[model samples]
Target: MNIDQAISARHSTREYTTQAVDEEVIVRLIGAATLAPSAMNLQPWRFTVIRDQALLDRISREAKACLLETLAPGAQSERFHALLDDEHFQIFYHAPVLILISAEAPGQSVVEDCALAAQNLMLSACAEGLGTCWIGFAQRYLNTPQGKQALNLPQTWVPVAPIIVGHPKTEPAPVAHQAPQIRWIG
Candidate 1:
């Protein structure tokens, strides 16, 4: 698919099939991600790919607990709390691949750079007929000591995006979009 097609088709896919993604495809996606521009040529992004079912489940459970413990009592947090209470809920959705994107530097710009890379990866995956979803719930746990040890990430690295990649069980219908609110000053 073309870039425009890929961009248009790309959406967060939660459910996935048991089929595994090819290593070559994963490599290509990462390659595309690395091509994203960074601030002052500082490519601070690092990626950790997780395919182990047990590890993913552990992360899901720990992340749920962490969110519950840390999030302040508010209506905004209720949805996540409910999801966590569901025993069938898996944060990674049991996808075949879980890619954690992290930044080596502690800066807002570094996080944005890593996010750009993630966008590239997702779009690339879409073009390759793969599904990807950025799992925000995994971020908190992934930054913890145990999470770092689980992924073998360094202390310097901070998790930016936790994305699950796999073959979608079904083609999802397009979601409606709102028009951009533009204010041009010329």
Candidate 2:
């Protein structure tokens, strides 16, 4: 698929099949990620792929706990509170793979640079007939000391995106989007 087609097709995939993505396909996607523009061409992002279901489950549990602790009472609302409190709510949505886009070192625009890479990765996945979702709920926990230890990553590596990828159970229907509110000054 072309870039425009991929852009339109890509959405946050929540349900996935049991099949895992091939290593070569993942490598190709990461290649696309590396090609993303960076500040001063400093590609400070690092790729960490996790395929372990047990690990993902543990991370989901811990992350939910962390988020629950940090959120002010009534900040998350009742519905969200129930969801986060549910033990069966997998934050990664049981996807077979998680490609973590992390920053190996600090930079003036490392987070922004990594985010661009993440977008590239997700779009590439869409082109490859795979579904992906950036799991924001997994990001904060993966940056914690315990989370770093679980991944055997240094404290300095900041986890920016917790993107899960896998074969989607069924193609997701497109959701309505609002037009951009533009204000041009020229």
Candidate 3:
């Protein structure tokens, strides 16, 4: 698919099939991620791909627990708890691969660069006939020391986002929103 088609078709997929994504496909996704534009071409992003079921489960549990401990008692936290039930946690949409995006410390634009990389990965997944979900919620815990140790991430790398990838069980229709109101000065 072309870039426009991928942009139009890409959507967050919360459900996925049981099939596994091949290593080559993941490599292609990473390759696409690398093509994203970066500030000063710093390219400060790194990825950790998790495929082992036991490890995935451990990360999920730790993530949820960490959120529960830290998040303020608010509607958002309540909703998170409701959505991330035991069943949802068990399968994680049954996606075979979880890609953790991280950024190197030092640059002020590191977060933005990481976000760009994530968008590229998601768009590339769509082009490859795969589904992806950008999981920012996972960062709440994945940034912690326990999460760092769980993923064996380096101390200098800060976790930014996690993208879940697999064959989608259901495709979400595009969501509509009002166009942005901008003030343009020529």
lDDT per residue, candidate 1, 57-121, as tens digits?
Answer: 98888888888899877787787778888889998999999988899858869888999999999
lDDT of 3 by residue, 1-186 (tens): 888899889998888888989999999999999999999999999989999978888787777767666777888878877766555564355578999889977478888998999999999999988999877668877788888899899878888868999999877877897899999999
How many residue pairs clash (N, CA or C atoms closer than 3 angstroms) in each of the candidate models, in the order given? Answer: 0, 0, 0
lDDT for model 2 comes to 0.92
lDDT (C-alpha) at residue 37 in model 3: 95
Worst 10 residues of 2 by lDDT: 71-80
TM-score of each: 0.96, 0.96, 0.92
Greater-TM-score candidate between 1 and 3: 1
Error of 2 at 112 (Å): 0.3
Q: Which ranges in model 1 have alpha carbons more than 4 Å from their true place? A: none
Candidate 1 colliding pairs, count: 0
Off by over 4 Å in 3: 84-91
- A best-first ranking of the candidates according to their lDDT comes to 2, 1, 3
lDDT of 2 at 114: 96
Which residue pairs in model 3 clash with each other?
none
